[model samples]
Target: MNSLYAMPGNEAFAELLSLHTGYQRRQLLLHHFPDSETLVRMAPPTPGGDAVIVCTLDRPDPKALPLMMAAATARELGAARVGLVAPYLAYMRQDKRFHPGEAISAKIFADWLGHTFDWLVTVDPHLHRYATLAEVYPNAAHVVHVASQLAVWIDAHVTMPLIVGPDQESAQWVTAVSNLLCAPSVVAHKERHGDRDVEILLPEMDKWRDHTPVLVDDIIASGETMVQTLRCLHARTSLPPVCVAVHGVFAEGALEGLLAEGAGLVVTSNSVITDTTQIDISKPVAEAMVSLCEANPTETARRTPA
Candidate 1:
């Protein structure tokens, strides 16, 4: 019998998931009204069979309601288990209460997801404050590392490259990507004046002027970090740097701004579907969900801390 069906914006990933785990691909029928409300019409999983809902939560508030409905309906119709594959998980940044009235948004969001789904799988969530996904999520959570795929992309596209990070926060991520590429890495010093205002100081790269600079980041929201990096690089190297990010959430014309700042080519993994998402992580996500399904059906062990 056929296995799971993927949601909209996830058709490509469904095809790759099938290739990885032999799970059949089908669609979840959905639509938006003139007033911007969502509707879901999809076949539930067969009795004793499972379902996987693939939804990328980039612009999350609008997407969450329908996704929750889909999961609930699948179970109402007799699904044995339901799993969520959200590659670009949102609202994961605010781990603590910065202000007095602020909500522990990440923990609250995790509660909603934990109570709704039996298992979860995602890629490179903002983990600066949290140690692991399990800490935020109350169930089986899998995080897909994008460095391997990113390294492959660099090898195939960039020549004589120097991997670089825009600030100290990106040191671990940049080092991981550089190690995979077997390329030298640099982490520039940066001070955040405000959310969008940042000052950067780059190291002297006069000796490696021949190499192309490849700026690697986990997420790009305002693109200021990259713009500053490109500005510093222009004085030392003649070539435009190839920019790569795991999550390309180009808010406020980040894509155009990067190109305007002399970025050679901007690219990212399929974590967040953007014009620059050129790499795929379907195999790792599929493997994670399938393993959860194969684990003892009790669902108790999945709640254990990772």
Candidate 2:
């Protein structure tokens, strides 16, 4: 009798999750005031039944407050347990303080979310420094790996794909997808100058001349890394390359820029709900939610960070 509630901008994904989990679906209504405050409301959740919130935290700053409010409202409305399903979790990149007097945003954000919800589910979080989500998120957190999903898409669409990781951070994902497809793979070397500036050096691809290159990564924000990789790739090979990522957080016309920079195609999971989101991740996400629901929230709360 759990009810899945979709926050604004996440209705379609929630509906899909509802179908997959056999959970009744509802919308968490939001009204924004002129001063930019969001008022959250929803139908009273079933007593003793779990209340699940479906949201993808891409541009997370604006959405975070409303999400916290919704969780609090759900508790007041009588739900026995409240959980969050954020497919593309944000604020995971800043796991440590890089400079003097800098706040470790990743830990701060994780702590905030941990205090808000009883349990959480997400797709591949950017774990550059942290080993896992549980390292930061205090409450019970489950990660739904989408390697099989990405591999299935590549196997179905691409022919003789040479899976390529744009940088060392992407090596894990690239290896997973390639192993699943039984395809050759390579990882590129990236030197980031700034947030908007990056340099890419692709490994010699003379051996993969006949194979189609498929660049895989976890998130595509500015798309500069992918664009630079495409430039390096086109200089060495004649075949047009394809780009695949889990979260398509395209900023400042990045998707159009990629296509214009000679990318043949760009695809991502439905985590961010872009036009390029062709892969469905609802099944795995739903399964994770169900698994979390089966566990006692009180036991999970015991694992909270000190």
Q: Give the winner by lDDT.
A: 2
Question: Lowest summed lDDT over 10 consecutive residues: which window, candidate 1?
Answer: 297-306
lDDT of 1 by residue, 134-248 (tens): 8889887788887888888899999889998999878877899889888988999998898789999998778878899999888888999999999888888877899999898
Judge candidate 1 at residue 263 and give its lDDT. Answer: 95
What's each prediction's TM-score? Answer: 0.93, 0.97
In model 2, the runs with Cα more than 4 Å from the true position are: 302-306
Q: Summing lDDT over every window of 10 consecutive residues in candidate 2, give the lowest-scoring window.
A: 297-306
Deviation (Å) of 298 in candidate 1: 1.8
RMSD (CA, angstroms), candidate 1:
2.5
Clashing residue pairs in candidate 1, if any?
A: none
Supply candidate 1's per-residue lDDT for 293. Answer: 72
**Decoy 2 TM-score against native:** 0.97
lDDT of 1: 0.83
